[model samples]
Target: MIPEEEGVYVFNREARSWVKISEDGPWVPKEDGTYLAYFRNHICPGCKAFDRVWEELIEKCVDKLHAVPALVQCRNFFFDCSDRTASDTFLLFLVNATPQVIVMVVEGGELRYVERCYGFEIESVEDLLAFANEARERMRKYAEEGEAESEEESGEELVVEGGNWKEVVEKLRKLLLEGRNVREVCDERGCRFVVE
Candidate 1:
């Protein structure tokens, strides 16, 4: 008996607020800080079993972290109870099972997926809180690393050699897009490339 039109209601403990979100409405962005999302399905037996545990976990960790509870419904199975936003969110995270918990945070103005736990991961409320804490620490570390990299980049200079500057730049661009480390790229190419 879930209302699809209502979308999803989640209590954000960090903001100490309630957020009603939809794919067509206000969605949580990375700039908003850290949040946990719980994906579930109404007809799922695992979800039913995890419901009680989730409630207890919320009660125990309400003051420690923020969480968003979302119910994902299959269009064919629960047509009337299907929520587009919830379903989309589930797909966005590549969730293939019910009772999935994901910790998300904002780093450099972009959403970062921190950690995820399935139904079997939660034996108690403390376990869930611990997972949240781990995710927070990870986000903090990533933010710090990003800041350090930017600071270093600001002070460095790019020295492109030879005549084909465009080709060199293109190769550098491809390396960056491939997620290779900048320092490693520079060391391997023996070129001092500065990212502006």
Candidate 2:
């Protein structure tokens, strides 16, 4: 499936509504970073460039990353800026912002990494793929670290190893090189699972 290409939409918790605020390629995010409520009303138009870029990304990444299946994604940030609340959706697009990809792991609404460079670069498609793979790696590390912290609070040994995720990373490498559907690959490889 293709990702969103245009303006702000609102995701209302109460009514489960997606109200679209704009229809053009360029859309502005509100002060609170919300577009979901607007999109539900269905008024926003699609962006051609964003559509093209993300379509290419999905085609290139779907077979390598199981992430698509697991996350309800939207390109909240389009013009190098987005509000904090806009990131309620799984993905945020820092379009034309930097020459790199930034992966953030938020658990309980808290940032996990301090220093960037989890392979986030804009040099090439290879760079994006590396960023994606490394992003996942870092997220896994964050989760395990969180688990470790929880365990430490309760007094337990850390049993999970980062080595376990290496297999998925290898598959990701194949998908990046061969241009595979990583969303499907993840399910088949059991890296990450989501019904939709």
Candidate 3:
């Protein structure tokens, strides 16, 4: 479980909304625990549309996964885009898009990114539930195996410039998640993406 001091924003099941748990740096759970995080921007239409189903998922996942729910609002930064304090948190999670669902696990104070799903892919509460179940299974594996390698560790770093968030997300989803070797500028304005 996340320590009270480290819990920055938590989901309130009764209110069915995100609540500020503490004014802290990084804004992610750090102590040993299983966490479900919703990453979004202030002005994203997809994030707005996902609210209802996200609330439903929170209710279901709390009991089913035994995971604490968290929220990261990426307000205005170009790359990381989280509200003032959580920008580093977004970068730490490598979230390049709004409306992303991530599952994180912390063991012995080490944080690991376990699973992720984009909002568009989650059509209903059931989809989110499936995502949660997968994350739960992965977390179990991590605990049993002792420090399994994460996606962030396996992939090379990507540096993107001049692209809109949507385009960057699409390209990254393909390159990273789908394991495609396709390389294309992410925007009409001629963006540059370099994998190093």
Top TM-score model: 3
**lDDT per residue as tens, model 1, 103-177:** 877667666655678866687777877777678777678879988898777665665453343354345446443
> What is the TM-score of candidate 1?
0.57
User: Across residues 1-196, which tens digit of lDDT does each residue of candidate 3 receive?
Assistant: 2222222367665766667653333555657877878776655667767776776666555666556778776543224343434554554556666578787776776665467777877888877766766775776776666544553256565555422434544454455545434232333211222333
Superposed Cα deviation of residue 49, candidate 2 (Å): 8.1
- For candidate 1, the per-residue lDDT at 25 reads 21
Cα lDDT listed for each candidate: 0.54, 0.32, 0.58
Cα deviation of 103 in candidate 3 (Å)? 0.2
Off by over 4 Å in 1: 1-6, 12-18, 25-30, 66-81, 139-196
TM-score of each prediction:
0.57, 0.30, 0.59
- lDDT (Cα) of model 3: 0.58
Task: Say which prediction, candidate 1 or candidate 3, comes out ahead on lDDT.
Answer: 3
* Residue range 68-168, candidate 2, lDDT tens digits: 21112233222111422232221222221211223443334333332232112233445444555566566568778998788668655644232223343
Query: Sorted on TM-score, highest at the top, how do the candidates line up?
Result: 3, 1, 2
